[model samples]
Target: MNSNKAVFDSLRNNLKVHYDGKRFSYKSKHDLKDKSQLLVLIRKFPEGIAVIDLKDAYPNVMDDLQALKAVGQIWLLSNFDSQEDIAYPNDPRMVIKVDDDLKQLFPRD
Candidate 1:
């Protein structure tokens, strides 16, 4: 019984360490699998797509845009505001487009 308890504790500790390591190493910005569809849509328009259109198509448009922007995978442009200004994703004037370097990753059909 004591030996079994010891083995269980050792396994638990090992798993905890492994989980912690993986959790820290994972970067949400770099993980775009869930946002692939959004990327493809953005890639379709070279000049950029309207944020309102994206919002209409994607329920989580803001989160997806911010995640892509965080990783330099996409750019959010607003004709009325400077880059430093906060642009609302729901605004019709805002545009979302894939980064030029990453354009190849999301090829248009």
Candidate 2:
């Protein structure tokens, strides 16, 4: 299977994780004191899912993505316009393409 397929398959078989509308709750356990991108946070789980914002994301997204690959399988969501720009391995399943998705998740009340 390809990288995207691998991520989806893993998400299906492994445990499912949720986003708290903020940083992941398990950050403390993993010693991720510094603000990390959503990709980095997903690595905390043996396998998990999360929607990340490309705007406030970490600078070294590439490194974070590599780290996730090492830990296990993962699927991420982002507001990226071009999939080719970030799809290093060309794993479409690795990222969920969504525009204004995060805004809806966290609306201004």
Candidate 3:
């Protein structure tokens, strides 16, 4: 199912950088459809990667969900972290969570 190949192509062709003056650019080797793909993303952009509505992106993918928690990259979808089962209840990084409302990050979604 090529749900949205154009989006995927864009992501693959032009890797976005955080531009923290680090000049770091990332290449996404895989799509964010499953845990394995998420792991590839982690391996590619572990330091500064953001995912919005992570559940919508990788629904029912346990490995992807766990990787999000393990890597601490998916910030906007804080609902996942607040769950009682998660290790972190009150995340100290609540300050940055506000960016989730920006919506411009993943405009095509």
The lDDT of each candidate is 0.55, 0.42, 0.45
Candidate 1 vs 3: which has more lDDT: 1
lDDT of 1 at 3: 50
Model 3 poorest 10 in a row by lDDT: 83-92
Ranking by lDDT: 1, 3, 2
Best prediction by lDDT: 1
Q: What C-alpha lDDT, on a 0 to 100 scale, does residue 70 get in candidate 3?
A: 62
Off by over 4 Å in 2: 1-52, 76-109
Model 3 over residues 1-109: C-alpha lDDT tens digits? 1368685555445534223343434523234667656545544543434443233344565555565666664432334554323222223345355366676667673
In terms of TM-score, which candidate is stronger, 2 or 3? 3
- Candidate 1, residue 44: CA error in Å? 1.0
Worst 10-residue stretch by lDDT in candidate 2? Answer: 23-32
lDDT of 1 by residue, 1-109 (tens): 2358686455445522323422322222222344777776666566666665455343566788889777666777776653332223232235586688899788699
Task: Give per-residue CA lDDT, model 2, range 50-93, as digits (tens).
Answer: 33323224355556665655654443434355442221122435
As a TM-score, model 1 comes out at 0.42
Candidate 3's TM-score reads 0.28
